[model samples]
Target: MNDIRVSDATQGAAKSAGRKRLLQWLHQIVFVGPATFFFILIVLIPFFLGVYYSFTDWNGISRNINFIGIENYTHILTKDPDFRNAFWFTVRFTVVGILLTNLLGFVLAYVLTKPIRTRNMMRTIFFMPNMIGGLLLGFIWQFIFIRGFAAVGEATGIGLFNLPWLGDRATSFWGIVIVFVWQTAGYLMVIYISSLNNIPKDVLESAEIDGATRMQVIRHIILPLIMPAVTICLFLAISWAFKMFDLNLALTAGGPFKATESVALDIYNEAFTNNRLGLGTAKAVIFFIIVAIITTIQVRATKSREVEM
Candidate 1:
């Protein structure tokens, strides 16, 4: 009789445990199911469809698409001077934009973290540009470069603002860079602020007690502690600079002989302007591969430098 009771108890406990596991799984599904479903529907489906269309010769309005294996890729690599120029231009812009944005962001973050009378107001002023949409900001800056700068130059007799800011290749390139850095630096500053705030006060105090100067403390202690923020900032800045399009469109429109055309803009032009969906998709695929590889390498490199708290 005791053996029978023991067997019944064990069975009951196993049933209860199974029910608990089932409930937990249902709870997870209830929370995570909708997001997973939407992501697969929106992002994954479109991506795979784009991949399929990249190998075909499909115009935007075509009902028939013939598969042309690797032709588009070959043409882009060997024969397309515009694409080559755009790629090189994008690379240069990205390098300069990333460095300037990160440096400015870090500097702003460092300064604002100090106890100042108008720190909050200053942060708000700095971050206001980021809140504006890129397209709108581009248009605003366009006017400023054209009319506002001209007015200032006339009044002050300064040659700096009077130059043809967007009409020349050199000025157009640097004009976009200046706008990009100004717009993006503030956003990265917020990330740095959060990271800086999280650093332990005791660690900083200890460094100071050990006779570390302001520069030494920042170089050795503060930087290492906030490296995770650096990783995030680098990733964000790289993505922004590499994929810049709206600002390029509204500001320069690849003008001054297409000197400032980005790969994103090139892809847009190839598809919509030229009505070559297949070629555009091919360019997009190539762009994706390059960006993925570069960002992955950057993330891994930065993560390797992250010091444990």
Candidate 2:
């Protein structure tokens, strides 16, 4: 009798849980139908179309497309100098942007969380640039680089005020990095702030009681505890850096030659400007694969480091 009662109770509970899950999923499907549908239409459909077109010679303006298997990929890899330049430039940008933004963000987050009077205000000011639209922000910075800098140089004796921030290759590269770091650091800071807040006071106190110095505490306790945050910020920075287009377009316009054109800008130029939609689609597909591979590697590396905290 006891065994039968226990079995009956377990079965009833399992059935109840299964029904609850089904009902919850059904509710979500009903409520999120519009968003899911729109995402499928807008994002998924275009993505699939782009993938399909990678293997076909679809000129943006034409209806007739030849089924050219691997020509687009071959052209981009073997024949296209422009694609190579853009790919390398994007690689450089991604590396630099990831390092600077994440480091500066971590520093700012650490400092702001300390007992400071104007820390909140400082966080707001730092984060202000991110709220602005990318295109508008790019144009605005372009103005500063072109008009404002020259005017300031004329008034002030500082040569940096007059130097061509966007004209040269090295300066142009750093110019993009500076702009990106300034805009992105605050967002990362916010993430770090949340991570810091979640670290229990007791843990910090324990570190202090153990005679650990500030740097020691940060290096030993805080960093390991916030590995998850580091992982998230690093991933965000890498992806954002790789996909940077609006700023590159508006600020440098890949100027002083095609020196600053990222892969995204290169793809845009190939597809719309030069009417090589198939090649552009190939680049996009390749770009997607690269991002996926990098993200997977990063996530695995970081997941191993994420502690119980």
Candidate 3:
């Protein structure tokens, strides 16, 4: 009887354990199943399809898809001068845009953090541009560049405003740069402001109580403490610069001899406009690889420099 009772108890315990395991699995499926399903259904499947399509001569409409191996990649790499031009243009724009956006953002953040009477108002005014859609903002700035600046130049006799901003290669590049900086800097400024606010007041006080000048405190204490914000801002800036499409579309439309054509826009034109979906997909794959490499490097480098309080 004692042996039988012991065996019954062991079986009961095993049943309980099995029930608990079942419940745990049910919980996970209930919570995580939908998101996983959608991701696999939407993003994962489409991405793999795109990869497969890149090797085939699919014009995005034909019923037939012929596999041509690496011909598309070879053609893009060797013969596509437009792609090369767009790549270089994007590179230059990204570099300049990153620098200006971050610099202006940091400056605005630093100044706005001070106790000024109109600080809140100034912040609102600065950030209002970001709230506008990129397409609308580009159109608004187009008017400003074409008409408003011309008027201002006429009124004030400023040659800078009178130049053909969107009609020339050099001026069009700078015009886009100006609008991009104006649109993006405020968002970065807000991020910087949050970072600036989180810094311990005691540290700044101690630095000040020492013989540290304003610049010294900022350089040593403030800058080091805010490296995380820098990392985030740089990543965002890089992504924005690289993926700039809507503004490029609305503002320049790759005009002035395609001087302002970006890689995104070029890929778009190649795929849809020229009906070379396979080649376009090849370019997109190359672009994706480049962006991934750049962002990874930037994140790692900045992450290494982040200092903990």
Report every candidate's CA lDDT.
Answer: 0.95, 0.91, 0.94
Q: Give the CA lDDT, 0 to 100, for residue 289 in model 3.
A: 94
Tens-digit lDDT string for candidate 3 (1-309): 999999999999999999999999999999999999999999999888888888989999999999999999899889999999999999999999999999999999999999999999999999999999999999999999999999999999989999999999999999999999999999999999999999999999998888899999989999899999999999999999999998999899987889999999999998999998988888998999999999999999999989999
The TM-scores, one per candidate, come to: 0.96, 0.90, 0.94
- On the 0 to 100 scale, the lDDT of residue 18 in model 2 is 100
List ranges where model 3 is wrong by over 4 Å: 1-17
Q: What overall lDDT, based on C-alpha atoms, would model 1 receive against the true structure?
A: 0.95
The best-first sequence of candidates by TM-score reads 1, 3, 2
lDDT by residue (1-309, candidate 1, tens digit) is: 999999999999999999999999998899999889999999999999889889988998989999999998998889999898999999999999999999999999999999999999999999999998889999999999999999999999999999999999999999999999999999999999999999999999998999999999999999998999999999999999999999999999998789999999999999999999999999999999999999999999999999988
Clashing pairs in 1: none
Best by TM-score: 1
Per-residue C-alpha lDDT of model 2 across residues 120-178, encoded as one tens digit per residue: 99999988998987788899988888899899999987899888899999888888888
Native-vs-model 2 lDDT?
0.91
lDDT of 3: 0.94
Q: In model 1, which regions exceed 4 Å deviation? A: none
